[model samples]
Target: MTSPMEMDKLLHVAQSCAPPEAIQLIVQVTEDPHTHTFAKLAEAPTIQKLALTPEGAPYVQLLRLYTTGTWADYLSMAHQLPSLSAAQVAKLRQLTILSLAYQERSLSYATMCEHIGLAKDLRESVRILEELIIEALYQNLFTGRLDGVAERLDVHSVTPRDVPRTADTHNGHDAVFGLLQALRAWRDRSSDAITALDTYKRQVEQKYDARAQTMQEDHAALTDALRNVAQSDTGMVARMRLQETYPDAMDVEANRRTHSKRRSKRTRA
Candidate 1:
């Protein structure tokens, strides 16, 4: 029999390894009476000398025995251990969510392996974490299945034919795996489209700005030429009016035009 403390330590180590069978075994031994007795014996001071014995029962069977025989008491005893590490707690949190989402008796080894592998990257891990949390909340708040006890809650087992071994990856959450993949792909495509649209918008804006600047320069040149023509025409009208009133003014204006024309020709030459 393992001491309560010893069981706790073993369970902790098992959880670190993230073996699916190990998790189920821990749950079982903690719930069983006969296993619990051995576990307690293992905790005894004299037996403690043999605590590290290699001949001890496999950890999973021990856990299963405890869980089956004394489920409630085993849970109470297990909870007495100091809390798990933050990372371990996080992993358990994910497991709890998956347990509810899949409606399984417990998280299977395949599912556990898939989750751990998928969670290797922080971004993907966080997303998986959130999905698990939401699934847990759904089960608890709406379904009233906090511990995954409902017989009908278990996910339907997939047929062997449905398995996609060609992908070269183990998929843990097969129920939602296809949807997740599609969503990720859509997000990537949408992001690329937005980037392309922004680039096109900048290019169009630059073209319009350059065209506007060219038009402004052309307008300024046309305005200066018009102003010069208007001034010259006004001077000609004034001279004509002065010539009608006095002929001598007309002669002076004529002489200025002849000299102005010569100067204009010389500048052009």
Candidate 2:
């Protein structure tokens, strides 16, 4: 299976070559299972230029049929347009199923039959529809079950068909712009949260530093008070020791002072 990228490159190479070769390549890409998208091919300048010519008109229409039209669409235009091969028809049917699945998960038998333009007879229509669905299952187009009793197709999942060119272009732009906006919003929110965290961290650090400084200052003041009390205690203790050692000398000094005062009073008398 060719990747979409390779298919796109092939498309450009086709358009660059002769007209006959280019149409052939385009048809192959349209029928390619992996080449499910067609907006780019349809919009290619070479294809558009060719489509303006008489010979290239029908082929361009065929590409559009595969791009946005269904099997019923082909049937309606079969008289005027080129017919598709068995594989291409099958793929178209599968693409139709995918489109239906996208619209609703539970598709009624009648609705699907009418959409695919199946047989009018109920029994024949159901049998053919079931066969197409089973074939699509093998192709991995979708995961679904035919609800015979309910007369519906219960779809679990489906590969998406290509978007119409107009819608594809518009939605592509919107999707890109929306993604950019979301990324910007996310960046802003993340930046704000980081800033708030840093601010809170700084506040906590400042508070801690202030508390630590206060503690140091109080410690220094307490140390100075203790040192002063220690010096005073040492001086009083030395004086106490000196008085204990000179007890008799201290008494003799006191008595001599008292006797001198008494003799001076007698002389005066």
**Most accurate candidate by TM-score:** 2
Residue 164 of model 2, lDDT score: 53
TM-score of each: 0.27, 0.53
- CA-only RMSD, every prediction: 19.1, 21.7
Cα error, candidate 2, residue 156 (Å): 2.6
lDDT of 2 by residue, 21-98 (tens): 768866787677655667667777787787887778788777777766677778877876666776676567766776
* Candidate 1 lDDT by residue in tens digits, 122-234: 55664554454445444332232223232123333311111222322223244246546757987999999999999999999999999999868855654564456457858
Give me the runs in candidate 2 sitting further than 4 Å from their true place.
120-127, 165-269
Model 1, stretches more than 4 Å misplaced?
1-12, 15-25, 28-187, 235-269
List per-prediction Cα lDDT, in the order shown: 0.43, 0.71
Model 1 / residue 114 / CA error / Å: 25
Number of clashing residue pairs, candidate 1 = 22
